[model samples]
Target: MTPRSIDEITARADEFADMFEGYDPKPGDLDAPVPPVMAVKLAAWRRDVAERELADAVRAAREQRLSWREVGNAIGTSGEAARQRYGATA
Candidate 1:
C-alpha cells in the first residue's frame, strides 16, 4: 500500500465527516411524517461508505504495524472484538 500523506489522510477524514452531515434521522422527529424511500436508500449508501472506510482504516493500521489491541483501543472495543469485526474484511 502506498503511504498516505498527512494531507491525504486529513482530506479523507473530512470526507468521512461530511458523509454524516444533515442525513441522520432524529429520534425526536418520530411524530413527523415518514421520509421518502429515497431517504432509506441514502442511509444504506452512507452505511456502505462507512463500512468501506472502516475496512480501509483497519488495513492501513495493520500495515503500519499497529497491534490489534491498539486498533481496538482507538475504536473503543476489545482487541478480539475489533479483530473479529474487521480482520477478515481488512
Candidate 2:
C-alpha cells in the first residue's frame, strides 16, 4: 500500500479521537493494540503533532528572546550544545 498523505493521517487521528472522546482509556485499553492500519495512521498523526509542537516552542522561545544558554540549562544540556542545535533558528 502507498504511504498516507499528511492530511489523511490527520483526518484518521481526528476520527480516532472522536472514538474515545470525553472518555479515559482503562489500563487494558491503553495496552491494547490498535488495528495495524490504525497504528500506522496514529504514528503519523503523533509525529506531525510533535513536530508542530516543537516548531511552536522554538518560535515562542525566539519571540521571548530566550538564549540558548537559558534553554539548555532548562533542558539539562550545555549552553554550547543548545546553541549549536537551536541558536541558528532563534
Candidate 3:
C-alpha cells in the first residue's frame, strides 16, 4: 500500500481529530482492549519510536567517545554488532 504524503495527512488531521473526539462509547466499551489492527499499528509505532530513540542515544554515546563494547553492553548486544549497526551514524 502507498503511504499517505505528509500534506495529505495534515489536510485530514483536523477531520480525523474531530471524529475521534466525537466518540460516545457505551460503558462496556470503555474497558475493552483496542481492536487487533489498531493493536498491531500501535506496536509498530512503538517500535519505530524506540529505534529512533536508540539511534539518538547511540549517536550521543559515540560523541562522548564511549566504546562500541560499552554501547553494546548497555543495549544488550555485542560490540561488533553495535559497530556495524551504528558505525556510520556516529
TM-score of each: 0.58, 0.45, 0.67
- Among all windows of 10 consecutive residues in model 3, the one with the lowest summed lDDT is 23-32
Q: Which lDDT tens digits does candidate 2 get at residues 1-90? A: 999999999999999898889687777987887999999999999999985676577667868988767777866788788777766666
User: Who is ahead in TM-score, 2 or 3?
Assistant: 3
lDDT (C-alpha, whole model) for all candidates: 0.89, 0.79, 0.94
- Give lDDT: candidate 1, residue 73: 95
The better-scoring model by lDDT among 2 and 3 is 3
Model 2 bad stretches (over 4 Å): 1-33, 73-90
- Number of the top lDDT candidate: 3
lDDT tens readout by residue for model 3, 24-89? 898888788899999999999999999999999999999999999999999999999999999998
Between which residue pairs do clashes occur in model 1?
none
Least accurate 10 contiguous residues by lDDT in model 1: 26-35
Q: Which regions in candidate 1 have their CA more than 4 angstroms from the true location?
A: 1-34
Where is model 3 more than 4 Å wrong at Cα?
Answer: 1-30
User: What is the Cα-based TM-score of model 1?
Assistant: 0.58
